[model samples]
Target: MQNLILLLITAGSSSLCACTIQPQAEPVPSRHVSTIVIRQPRGEPGDFIICNDGRVLVFPVAHPKTCS
Candidate 1:
């Protein structure tokens, strides 16, 4: 009987060990709201966006070698 009780306690405590404790995030302050969406093409990885006012954003154009 005592071994059964100890087994139950061990199982309960081990289950509690699986619980996760996540750190809370700090509050962030923001003023302006802006959004940009970049769509991934079917196969290529060099795609980007140059949208105007959150709409009709065209894909990235060929950049000049020294357009820094």
Candidate 2:
């Protein structure tokens, strides 16, 4: 019937419209982190340790410098 042909045509057109190309999402920017390396002291007096949060810990004459 004419109604059945029209229905088929409408369905085909709807499916074709549904197959459209969409714009892709934007890519996120990557972050670069910088790391600082701290060397261990020779257990000498006046030796210091710099923590990750910019805290300075100085060792005494008999103790070793360590970050908690």
Candidate 3:
């Protein structure tokens, strides 16, 4: 019982003394991701298509006349 009380006191005292209160950091500025709006030409088949999500998509243009 004495050992338990002594252990508790030692732990409590050490934990209380080991603390360091540091200054709080400043709040970070709100970040705004601005998108650059560019006028993209319409893409033909086998050409690049500028998507609304800022991505380029290209698909093969199959000419049915050439597929004889």
Of the candidates numbered 2 and 3, which has the greater lDDT value? Answer: 2
| Model 3 lDDT, full chain set | 0.67
lDDT of 1 by residue, 1-68 (tens): 99999999999888777554445677888888899998766743344554445544334355422212
Writing each residue's lDDT as its tens digit, candidate 3 over 1-68 gives 99999999999988777654545578998699789998755765464567667776656566322211
Could you tell me which residue pairs clash in candidate 3? none
What overall lDDT goes with each candidate model? 0.60, 0.80, 0.67
Best by lDDT: 2
CA lDDT, candidate 3, residue 25? 73
Model 1 error, position 50 (Å)? 64
* Consecutive 10-residue window with the lowest summed lDDT within model 1: 59-68
**Model 3 misses residue 39 by how many Å?**
39
